[model samples]
Target: MVRWVRALVVGAALAGMITLAGVVLGRIYADPLLVRLVAGAAIGSVGLSVGMRRLPNWTVAPLSATVLGAYTIVGLKLAAGQADVTGPLSQIARDSLVNGIPRLLTAMIPVQPAPDTVVVPVIAAWLAGLAAAEVAVRARRVLLGLLPVVALYAGALYVVGPNASAAGWTTPAFAGLAIVALATSARPAHAEVPEVSAKLRGRAMAGAAAGLVAVIALGAAVGPWVGGQVSASPVDPRRYVQPPQVDSLDESPLNRISGWALSPEQRLFEVSPTGAKSRTVRLRLAVLPDYDGITWRVGATYRNAGRVLPQLPRLPDATTADVRQEIVIDGLTGRLLPVVPTPTEITGARIAFDAATGTLIRPEQLSTGLRYSVVSEVQTPDVNLLPAADVPSGNAVARFLAVGPGVPERIQRLADQLADGNGAAFDRATAIEEFLAEHYRKVADAPSGHAYPNLDFFLFGPRAQGGQVGTSEQFAASFALLARLTGLPSRVVVGFDAPAGGGAVTAGNAIAWPEVLFNDLGWVAFDPMPKSKNPRPVEEDFTPKPTKPPTPPSEPPTSADTSSSSAPPAALAAATDGGPGAAVIAGGASGSVVLLLAGLALALVVMRRGLSRRRLTVGTPDERIGGAWAELRDALRLSGRPLPAHLAATEAAAYAKEPSAVRIRRAAPASEAAPLPPLDELVAGINTVGFAPGAADDAQADRAGSQAVAYATALRARRSWWRRVWWSLHPGPLRWRRPL
Candidate 1:
């Protein structure tokens, strides 16, 4: 039952671990379902395998450490999007040595956008530590081994940080070395305590040491080869670039209001005239005081709004006038109170007041505390200017105009009326504008809403229809549409009305108006709002100086080829206009430093091996000749040759017929001399004196063994050159063959 419970616990833990891994990987990579599932399953399996294991705490500790450590390292890389490192383990070690611990640590850290490759040793080391910990005997030791693993987990948080690449190696190496040390320190089976037997243990240690050296060398060599493969793959540039613009207005109500609102309280103009002004001078200035349901953009051209009457006098030519003035305002009620206009266009004027709202207006609500100056062009009639045919259509400034609601019908009607029986465009447009302006009554109070599909609202509403006055937006739309109907191009312009009295106007005092397109003259402004005897021109208070357009930034060169010395100075200058090449240089220098360190490590390992004592005890001539011949026969079988049945030792030697065999025969005792030592005697002497048993005490056995080893070494040295000759002279059931 305990075992079943353990299994159940393991299963539950596995499921939880899987879920955790899935969440982590999903968040990190956003990979497809299949990929994420596979990754989660693999990670969970590792965790489950360790959790279910029955072992001492010490052993279990290292294994657990290794597993979690590897997972963390791999997880970081997976998150960072780097490809796995495919080179040998030794190369990873070498890289650690040269680049210092930082780079390796970085490799371990997971970056937001993962790289194409991940380091495999980091993962392997982690797994090794985890596996080792699982078998640990003491809980304390397990905890101790895991301390570094915990630190590594903490370090991974910074993997995607600036030093991420440098931090990657820290946890993996710490975990790996700890596991290796702990595993090596553990006792063998049946041993109550750890003991290091001098002779046997020394040999084992030597073998392990040699194996490690070899692994390191192999890894170094293999790492570059693997790196080469990775470098050979192509990279796509477009994958890393980002797009250009994002709208700032949609989500914010403030921005929306700022972008689209048109309030009449935000004065449209302040007017004053030069010379003897009349007691009642009509103030004419374009005004679009409020925003209706439809939006009015900056730039678009439209046809006239009403019928063209050829019987009307010709309209005056377009002209421009700059007007400036000031008016005192009442702050308590936010109203423009009546004040005598100095240098006013008309005298004896009294500002009309809206008693219900405590506001003053000459048909429009005026905002308080605004000051501005404006430059506008008005076409004053001269000799009843005759309307022309052939209306002008295209104009560049027309792109900046836009219409409000109810605009399309007005434009169509104006266009149709102007084009009436007159095929020419200019005459039709002129006729339409003149007829509409002359017929439409300029009233301060129009109905709350204009009549749908009708032109009577402006002519008869409010004072005529008994409803609250319609806003300037409705009036402008109606006017612009009718103008377009007569073939005249027109548009609605939204801005602020600046009142005179403040120092300088700001965006808070914005206004709007309607503009019509004319041939050669561009957009001409005309105000349809009724004016009092003492008129205030809106443009005079807020006209600002023209601003210069901004210059574009230059782009720098990105390609290394362009920066080459042979390129002209101008070419180089042009190429470098974008940004400096510091990143490229830094990366190259870093890579070079890594390579140098790797090379130095390899050289050190080689030099150390060459200086070691084990390298000095190789065999003498007799041993080489005899042992080599035997080894050569064994090798022949490995190479797929068959040995002869019923072959005597002497026969086998004769069959080999090597030059070494001739040397062996010559070295043997004569028939008369003491009988030659048996092969068994020689074998025993070699095993006891040279290899295992002490040889220092017996000079004779030592000398004989030395001679045999020397002979074997010499035979091996010459074997290759003599192989063909020896085989041709004597062939056995299976001839000796060279290794492939």
Candidate 2:
């Protein structure tokens, strides 16, 4: 019992020592600190179990557990920086009073994100220690010898700095406790025969010590290797805004202004009329009241510009058609633009632009381009109505209607000359539209600057200038303003005029027309342009030109086969016939199948060979028992006494009446014994040949060979019923089979 206890202690101590070595080596390799610590604890526990025979059982368990726990704490500290902040612990403590507590808790949870580096090693050490303690207690040992030394080491650590050296002290303290318990409970020697030989005891102790050292070395080596392969690299650190510049122009006030420049390339307006050819439309143009510098500033107004008078009865309803048109502009850089309808009160207006352009178009300077759309009602006017007794005041359009420039004066003068009396609003409006159409000529260019002040430049300027026409937008504005001045309610309508091509016309092809409002009818559109020889309709569709397809190149012809005939006939034939393109494919497939089959056959052969070798190498007590058993089995089979199935060599020997069996059992160093006939002599001879620091001579080798052969021959001789039975039971011939 004492010997067994010693053996167990030695094993446990050896396991612990090995673990410590591994941890130290691992640290040197820059392994994760946690990994190193855990590995160290585990190796220590293993070494203690397998190597340290003198270590007490009670000491092993607590010591191993404490070492492992310390390792775990160290590993955690090393890997703490890499833990995820949003993990379980973090989530739980997200709203907690103490920050990071939840994160710490989550990291401690096992197998969530991934296992900790120290987990395996720590667990291993703890388990090993536990097992060692249980084994020692079961063996009923007392008084562990190493307890005092461990306690001293732990006390020294505590004296240095209790809190700071907690990890260093914990392992030694546990080891001390384990050793004390084991030593106090250690069993006394028996009064009868000695349970263990001094030589055997010494060897066991030495092996345990060696194993402990091995474990410690292994732990040190493994720890650093694991750490380096696992951990993430470290973040870079930016300014927010730039400094402002001086003397920048003030653009805030521009937001309220409606006026915007239409570069030469910009489409000012678009016009599309139902069932009307897209011919050039002559119209009037005008600007609202505003101050002018290099450009006009038309302010946006919250006031309703075209509200109907309350005093006047509503005019009779007229069937009016609503025309839809798209207006596109060019050379516009910024996003937002102002859109206003002429003769106002017109709704159903919507504008769209690229999604990238948000609601606001900033830096309202000349560089910020603008575009919008307008919808207006147009219809023919009724030719009868009485003039109002008094026009409303504070109405800009009403005032303009009473005595505006251009067509108003001409209409009044013509009415006085023709009727010899004042004309009503309906009659005046009709006469003005006809007179203007007859008088004005549509041209591409009109007067600019002060030359076109009011409507005089467009209506009564020089004949050469009169024939010149500006954009449809200019024409429509001029006409609408003139009509309003002449007591005719009118407004300009801007929309797209489809071209003759068969495709959709965009805002890029915009045109404008005037709509005159007469009492009892509605607004009516009129074109004042002169007829041209090659006029194109505005509403015709335009189709895009078709694209051409690319052509393919012709393939070059293949050259005739050519080859020398000196090669093998089959090779020569293959070369002349485009090589082995098809045959090679077939051969490759066949070869692959053959290789696969051959590999499987080889594996089976190797497995069979291994099994046979294993069977042959049984029933031997020495370290190389496999080889001895093979020779013994062959020798027994030839003796004719069949060996019983599943019987141990000891039982078989007892039945054989061999005196050598007793000596075999008594051999102290079993590794030096040879299992064959004349077992006593063989065992003694082999013991003499035990491992030592010396070279072998030729005479020694011959003598050893001769002895081995003689023993084999004696085992083969059938002398008794037991021997004959063993021989008969065992197979005779030794067959050598080659590996597949």
What is candidate 1's lDDT per residue for 46-75, written digit by digit as tens? 354445465544565455555555554445
Point out the worst 10-residue segment of candidate 1 by lDDT. 301-310
State each candidate's clash count.
Answer: 146, 109
Off by over 4 Å in 1: 1-415, 422-426, 437-443, 448-475, 485-487, 492-514, 525-740
lDDT of 2 by residue, 1-740 (tens): 76665555544453443344333323312224533554455455545454444567666566666766565544444443333212343332222223222221222111111123234334544464445434543444333333322333333232222112124434664465456455555568655435557767788899999999999999899978767633312110001211111112212212111122122345343333323354432222222222221211222111111111011122364334433333343333332332221221112221111111011122123232223233323332343333331122234334233323233343223322222111334344445445444445554344332112534444444544453234454455555554443335454443334442223333334445565543344334566443453333221211123446668887753443234334467755676677566668899999999999778656655664454455433322232232333344344334322222223444434423333211221223544244444443333323443442133333443343444455555554423334444333332233421110
RMSD of each: 44.5, 47.9
lDDT value, residue 55 of candidate 1 = 52
CA error at residue 584 for candidate 2, angstroms:
99
The worst-scoring run of ten residues by lDDT in candidate 2 lies at 301-310
lDDT of each: 0.36, 0.37
- Quickly count the clashes in candidate 2: 109
With candidate 2 superimposed using the best TM-score fit, by how many Å does residue 211's alpha carbon deviate from the native?
99
